[model samples]
Target: MKRQVKPIREGNSEPGTVSLFSIAGIKTLLQFLRLGKKSGALLSMAVATAIYTWFYQWEFALGVTVMVLVHELGHVAAARQKGIPVTAPFFIPFLGALIMMKRNPRDAATEAYIAMGGPLVGTIGAFVSFLIGLFTGHSLFYAIAYIGFTLNLINLLPIHPLDGGRIASSVTRWLWVAGAAGGLFAVIFLKSFLFFVLWALFVWDLFSKYIVHRGKAAEYSCWGKIEVPFDQIPGENWMLIPFSEREPLPYRTYSDMDGKQWVDINWEEADVVHPVKMQEQGLIRSVFSTKVERRWQQTPKVVVLRYQIDYEPHEIENYYEVPEKVRWRFGISYGALAIALFVLLDLVQLMMNEQGGFFHSLRK
Candidate 1:
């Protein structure tokens, strides 16, 4: 016998009023759909839907698109709540969608929550679809459940730029190395062209980080002259020097290098120049180095000698260091991983033959 599924609404709330749940859902949707500069998100969403329609039937395409929309809106809501200005949900045809934050997150924990929002809400959506399929005998509902689950799983693959990867790296920046490894595994095992593309970006980022840390930057001795070519100057446009315990020191620069730029520094400042001994020593070392190299070495190394900005001549390394906060808790992070694994195992069963797969179970 087919199971009878109760409707969410018992009956009419009143003669002329909307139900509480309906109002809440509508308000939530409206809040996230608040399009400021990201009105283009709607256009992208339409394009994605059209493309999916070309690949599948309109009904299937619409269902999948709605699922993705819900997932991205989840991100939008979290960002807004965290007081981070963000763009609306922008969709990509096959690669899914994203919300562009206008500014950096307050901290690693904020970023982790924003990343988690999508999958948490998306999983709920998929589960709702699953229940609908189970009760209504609708294969389309089953497809939505399966596709939603799988898409979220792919997104949580702990690869840099992915939600899971971003969340993981927030705990410790070094974890990006692990993310890179996972990306490589995906490329070799999944053999997906998308994975290959993301992997290429990941590799470039890794190389950039390596060069930033171990190369291009100079440390201050007692007295040293660091001659950086105009082309070799770091922070050609904008520079952000962050201190762990304090606000980031920021600078803006113009691009005008005649030949080379150099800085003469005395290391004595490390002791008495600033109240703090440039805490978080390695914080921006890699970032600044990579930024400089990428800016200057676009083509052949040109020996240019000129001044670019109203340069400040100060000690080389005199910023106070700040301790990095371990925001992501092991228990919460591992819990999420466990849930993802459970979802994956369930997905596998849904695809299997003997376990009555998604289709077979739905048919009954």
Candidate 2:
């Protein structure tokens, strides 16, 4: 079943018609799509959503529409701060807008803020609404605020597409991993019994896909400026020549376009790559991809050994009572199952309400 995700906040509230759909990198997509501006896609989506919801549920629908708008505004706001041009914020129902950016985020700070735009708005809206509800004494108003606030907070919880999850991954991938573990544990401990099975499905998604996804990026801090120059580097390019595969290849081969017969240099004097690095504190463990020797000495080094990111050392160090596998099984995944159960029950209730015949069958 294609489970529909709603922008629900605190308690079980009515779902707004809009859903925000996002994939990892929109910048890359621009290149693929060969489009300088992507505001059109977002605009069209917003218009369609507004039109659709206008015909259907107008009032409850408007809140959803606003949240979607706020989310886009976040992107626009962040982009403006970074001196990047954001075309517009569109309000789309179910599928939200595509924020058109003049350029990609320049740095971590820029990325974090831009990423955080939507949820922050939701948080603010939720809090404001909540406070208003307190004054007006309407439980429903408070519920709306709670929904907005709670959804934003939950989205910030280090799950992808949700602001927090993306931010966590961008900042420190390991922190996000730890957060996942913690979230799993918390869900299990707090047995509200709502989202467990869904959590289990998420766990399965993690293991099946990204667990050992070996995308390793290494930088030796001690490497005192090995200046490898590029011919036509873009102004926005953050230069880090990635040694993806055969790391044994020391980066000594300079441009010989002048046609000089070069000897195969012994580059072993320089730094080497290792998955685990010895630091002032201890062995600094990098995640999944082994980052061979993190500290490249000023001296030359040849095909120093390369290492993939390994979880063994980390798992050993953070040895809890049980493996993450077992820990997650009982956690919010169960709550997800509960959610499924609740849905099933609600469906039954609705059917009974409509027919008043299911009970008759039970009595017979």
Candidate 3:
């Protein structure tokens, strides 16, 4: 005997059947995941916000997160302006947010320009917050403004990996000495063990770049002369070869185990007809010529090419080619920004104190 199954209800589907709404929801989720893959900024930012909210009040957490986002966007804008490729900002809960460069800046000036952008724009963001607090008389906005000013001010310390360190490359290396002293003071004042660790790292960087690698700095400077020997020339007719007739030479640039960079040209694979023509054209000659070997001068800050031709080594001091006028401009800007942040920090403190202190106002 066969048993009869219960009749399905009009509004209910079979057990195994999925609703149209579910399918649509799943498609939406998949699209969001794909977007996260392309740019993790939003997702990571959400995660950071969640973690910060867990530790502190949501208002403070959100404010700090937005401030950091503004700072990173400044860097992104500057990089774009300089035609440098960079990834979107990724946030770390306690640490901060950062953007990675796809390629290094070619010179100290470019690096400084990009570096200064973050603190410069970040200061503006904080100042805006300060104004909002003044208008609204809200302690929360004032508190955020104070924190923002402090963060940007700390970043102005001339230490490696810090914005000020890169800016100092175009200004003056002597600022690093000041950074060492300032970093120590920051560690003590803030009472942050993390900052102490950073200070230690900064000290080591100073020693490595300035003391240990002092001689090498001048020796491996960027700029070199390339020459093609007349003996290596295949024929006089090679020079007559049209530029379009010659195939492009393939080459790859990479860093060695010691972090020294090198450019390897595949001369064997290149069209032999192009070398002499490239030599006659000057600058294009190095990569096309079989007789040239290329080495890159690698430093903590910049990488520059050094070429060897026919066993002769030549060097050119073009790395720090930023004009004196530009250097003065960067110096003045850096100093003015720092002073402005300090003044804003004091103003925020005064306002908060009038409101019965930041903590008291927040509690109310």
Candidate 4:
């Protein structure tokens, strides 16, 4: 007798089935337009964003939107070049656009290029602005470029998830997960609410990428094992790994020869142990206390490949898929500084003893 082909069934609903998009029709439409998957929680985020945008529509805030959009588009453009299906940029008023990446990127190189694409665009934009500034003597042009490029540079840090971060991960797997965890904690301690939330969002993703869907036979070296707090750590039984109900709580342990003695480790092992969250959302000190949560509610889904990595028997609360090297290349750009520069220029405009009636006639 011939056997019929078996069907593959995932336990939960597919991507975009989350309950974060249960708001009203218009809000729902906007959320869907920006985000790919549907979730009830996203609806709440939409409501919140709409309310916040109502109060703050200042030019500076709008300019920040432009900076973020350009940064996101850099990734989008790279994705398009790589033949990845990407949604149009979703304009979120004072916030910014969130690209809806339909599928996981195929490899590290692809991810890196996509991640760098945004910063690259910003760098070019900044260069153009700098050129414009050189010609017109209008410092604001340079300031805009600075704002555009600086954020990209920050994203390029090899800490984890950032474009530069992926580069670091590709070099050493242990450092990659450790870097991600450290970056998350650092952002929280720093009081960067925006990045703090983004980091929190990755807690579960990290577990998924490192533990649940670990690459087994790949030629690349990765974190072989992670130890957590006695209670938080998974059981010693390796077969019991991959409990997805909760994200894996990964910790560190070092073993001596013959695998007898084991010692617990800490953030010191991580290549980059961030005190709080990342520096996104404009909050530098993005450390989240045990009480508060992250600010950026609408976290974009992280893209990652699968089946090649080995599996671990545990759970990760919030995991994220990221690239390597490109995240750490700070020398590549400096547009964020433009924000500060623009502030100073505004001051200069205030104090300049101009002969013509330009600032007084229009800008003022």
Best model number under TM-score: 3
**Model 2 TM-score?**
0.39
- What stretches of model 4 exceed 4 Å from their correct place? 1-59, 91-96, 170-190, 200-364
- Position 363, candidate 4: lDDT: 37
- What's the lDDT for all of these models? 0.56, 0.43, 0.69, 0.45
Candidate 4's residue-wise lDDT over 17-58, tens digit each? 556545356566766667544443344345445554465433
Most lDDT-accurate candidate: 3
How high a TM-score does candidate 3 get?
A: 0.65
Q: Scored by Cα lDDT, where does model 3 land?
A: 0.69
1 or 2, which is superior by TM-score? 1
Return the lDDT, model 4, position 132. Answer: 68
Better of 1 and 3 by TM-score: 3
CA displacement after TM-score superposition, residue 90 of candidate 2 (Å): 5.0
TM-score of each: 0.56, 0.39, 0.65, 0.43
* Candidate numbers sorted by lDDT from highest down: 3, 1, 4, 2
